[model samples]
Target: MYVSARERKLLERLLADDRDITVGELAEELNVSARTVHRDLQGLESVFRRYGLKLAKRAGVGIRLVGEEENKQALAAELFRLSHHEYTPEERQLMILIALLEANEPVKLVTLAHDLNVTVATVSLDLDKLEQTVEAYGLSLIRKRGYGVELAGSESAKRRLMSDLLFRHVDEHEFLALMKETIQKRADAPLDTVAEKLLGLVDRKKLAIIEQQIEQVKEKLPFTMADSSYIAFVVHLALAMERIKRGEAIHFDPRDLQALQATKEYEIAHELAESLEKVFDVDIPNEEVGYMTMHLMGAKWRNRQGTMMEEPSLTVGMKAQQLIRSVSDKLGVDLSTDRTLYEDLVVHLKPALYRLEHGMGVANPLLDQIKQDYAELFAIVADGARQLFGDIPIPDEEIGYLVLHFAAALMREKKGWRVLVICSSGLGTAKILAMRLKKEIPDIVSLEQASAFEWKGKDVSAYDLVISTVPLPEEYGPHIVVSPMLTEEEARKIREHLERKTSAAKRMEKEPTARRNKPIIDTMKAVRRISETIVHILDGFSLEVVKRRSVHEILTDACRRLERSGVIVDADVVVEELRRRESLGGLGVPGTTLALYHARSFAVLRPSLTMYRLDSPQTVAGMDGEPMEINTVVLLLGPADADEEVLSVLSHVSTLLVKDEQSAATLAYGGEDEVYSLISGHLEQFFDDYWISMKE
Candidate 1:
């Protein structure tokens, strides 16, 4: 059986972890489909048997490699040796740049073409973009007829560019392993050799020593450096030896040298240089020590527990603010107020500007990858930097780092689904269901339990999904009806059902195609129908005027009051998660003071929603320092594990909160019996209007 490069990766992954891994987990890790994994496993079975291994799979339990460790290790080694021959256009360009930058002598275009397995014309065309990439690193691709091609620039700049190019793909561990293996045996017994080795044919012992020196310097530093900055140090330290052996020299402005020497990073660098001087039996330069200081200046602290920073100097903070403002205005996402994003940007930009001003081309080997991954984000950062710095072209590499700050702010770090379990056999059965669901599915954020009879009248809309032993016919989205001791096939069925429902909800607003007679497929009517099922949860709806106070206090008080009704279990957990959500970003609606405070918790028995009208306008912090004041708040609570139906209603309700806040509030606070009547009546009307608008 022949294996493809991708199949090899699959075998590697299965062999790497001894524990069983679900198809979904494998698909996610390898960035492929579950079906693809299943097919690959079939192809792999025959191949694995030759290695004295078997692909062990159990229903609902995932797959694992069952065999001796030695066989698995040998098989893994063979997988790594296979050449990844196929290359994207971007990959080809990066490969050309790597060969040129690392070449000790001027490498011919023909040689690069042969290495990449491409024609000379294609290789030449790749160099056009490659030149622009290298030019950013303060190096020029100088082609001399017959002599071939060489990178021409300052020796220091060449090393920076080389450092960036060397570790573009792999992390520190992989790079070091390759370095160690290639070094410890370069002159001894050899394996099959590729034309251009990734780790380079450098002195392994020297490379290892440099790596240790860098680790030492990094640990001793006051501030934590960015991953990119650390990579630069490794490459710089390793290449410094190479350049020095070739009798290369470095010089810096005397004043700049004095300034760098005064810093702790420079002092550390000075000691490293002294150690290298003794190891290599050669004098080290002061200019190289200055370069190391610059690397330390751009680092982030490893331990930033509440210690963000005592305010940076006015100019530095202002520069960062200027860039953030530009991004907000142009991109329309105001990240200017995220305390962490702001601080990170300020610290990074100051050192970056210092480097750029001194004509240091900070090589970003990941520039191409970053641009490819976050193209829109990179553009926004570039445009914003353009406005902030005027004509000082900030390298694409620098822009990539800036994008990371905003990217962190934009990242929604959610772990998994908050699940509610409903069982006909009561608490014992419910707990059993929770354990079964958790074992097969690792994505259960929190597992809460309730008897079907107990949960029927409680507010349960707060949970992401509900798992029940038996179906009791609730219109709250979709619920998984599973056996108390779930089977693997049944678990997969549940996952499939949930995925379809989640996909359908996402597609609802997108494909609003009028299927004239099929109102069941129509999202608007689906929402109305689902919303009506929870009407019982909002029974005896009456609005009491809330006095002005913290929204947390108001919500917590409501939870306690509902606890007397035997609707909630743990009020403390629900309230704390709500507060944590608020801290990440305010839930307060803009324009109207309607803050939608909804939480998912095991405490919630069933889906419940109600509105409270405050007597006076309560001011809450809104986005970008805008004071948000609202007289009405709609508090929605669902089962600790909310289902698709509840999620769909929450989606529609979120839309309603933004659009009809005042009207919804007035209708709610108007009359008690009339409130429920008015809401039920309005749903049909809202559905009709929304459907018509969607059609048009």
Candidate 2:
């Protein structure tokens, strides 16, 4: 049976992907029109029939290939064996890159064209496009009429490019399957797939040895290495050994080497190198060990026992705070108190900044999906990263990670559904995945985490849903599989699963004889609490024009007014409390002419937000620690033992201070009625959301 290039590509995607792929998606992926994909499907029907398979198409949903496993394997094997002269543009380009990277000497255009079964002109066009890609890796593609072509760059750049290609093109399942095969068995036969072509770079026996060594060393590391990172590290070491055998060398900066030598990773890398030298019979250079150390340092870590802040750098901590504050201001949400978000960012940014500074890159496999799903949040984080990093060019991968951190923070709440998360380590990526699930699915009331090994025989009956990072055996029963960085599609599937279960449960239940019989007393009480808080603040709310030149004088005068208005018992005590809060961190909202001086004090009589506009702007330290001019001081006060409803209302007021440019301007310069109108409108919306959620 003849399988065309695009057809073969489509079939591979169908078999590899565990989700239904729509015609639009396939069309976009193949760079063809939907009609073209339909036509291709028409031709593929006969091939599927031959393999005892059928194409299942659902309108508005997608297409899926349905068949027995044996039939599917048979078709895959046949396709692998058939060697017809056809290649997609991506395949052809990848072949050319691999050929160039492998070739010690320049390869003629005629040779490349002949191998790819394409015209020299076609190969030249591919090179024209490929040049830009190679350049991004700091490699130059040398082309001449008579001299042929070659890739020129540092050995480190070449290695990185090769690793990137492997990670990008090779399916994770295929890689895992290859790893499962015995070294001797794999070495006996040459695999013919494009993935195998990349895998051929590392010797099978050496790859096994590297994996074994890394497995042994895993326990010694302070933080748990993600499964993906573990695989990448193994590939990295195997490739390094193969390259060393081929007389290729990587150069490390002497200064960088000196710095790395001080690290624990350096000591571990040295030991690993020594062990490899005896087994491979190759002298591992100090430079090679230094590069290995760099990889160790750059690996994503999730500490088990304590927070990532053990011996933290104040600089990175301050940057994390600055980034959080910037994003909070732009997003109009107060996330300053989210300790988990703070820890996650600090942990993520430490290795991330290291990778950025060293010109090393880590692949965020879900970057495109992240950008698609959280476009606005991604933009906010990208902007925040720029403001924090300043001159540093933070890649979208890092920004995608930052978005996950903030996205999780935004989703922080518990309501109804119960979920159990099973992960390999049950600490790092698992925590991230759990947070993402809760963030994406707010119905998740409680989440329980367990390692893969620990969850083998555990009772999961209490959980409403079970989700895992890795695939489980049939005995584990039914569960959804998702990446740590949950994709939109995965979230949709999870929600669908939950909806189906809910529908079934509703069907099984007896019909209610009457509806609306019970009054919503709790919701009524909640509404009353929120309403009273809003009323108290608005009744005492006053926006005054003050002439105080100093912060102390301004605070004293503001507190005296509050005391006289019966909002507080003692003006002196309230001023002291406000000053104490100011000393903890700057009250000035960065990049604005406004300051939010808020405190929860026992001396407070009621929750209130009062605006004091200064006659002359005065400089004060910003929340980000930068000095800024403030022409307005917004004093927000609440009782120390205030209820959740009162605190929620006060928090909403804090958000209004920097909700947006117009809101900030209104708070800083708008007349009392205009500002009060803005606050009332936002508070009304907040109450509506609260009421709706309560009903649900």
TM-score for all models, in order of appearance: 0.45, 0.66
lDDT of 1 by residue, 219-319 (tens): 56655544345545665666777777777766677897886775667878888788778777877778877876776664433232212111122234556
The regions of model 1 sitting more than 4 angstroms off are 1-79, 83-149, 171-173, 176-196, 214-220, 251-255, 299-314, 322-338, 358-383, 395-397, 410-696
Off by over 4 Å in 2: 14-22, 51-84, 182-184, 304-313, 415-442, 446-466, 473-696
For TM-score, the strongest prediction is 2
- Tell me how candidate 1 scores on lDDT: 0.62
- Summarize candidate 2's per-residue lDDT along 1-696 as a digit string, tens digits: 878899998897776555567999999989999999999999898889888998888888798888887899898888877765788888889889999988999999999999889999999999999999999999999998998999999999999999899888875655555555533565756545666677777676777678777766777786766555666777889889988988899998899798788777889889889888988899999999999998888777654223211223223545776789899999999997665566567767777788898888877666786787789999999998987798679988778778877887887675667688887532445656877788678877656666664566666555668898777777987788886767666899999988877655643331220112223666688789989999998888888888746768877887888888888889888889788777655777766798777777888989988888889989988876788999998888888777778877786666665445677888888999998999889888877767755554
Q: Deviation in angstroms for 267 in model 2?
A: 1.0
- Root-mean-square deviation of every model: 19.7, 11.6
Candidate 2 to truth, TM:
0.66
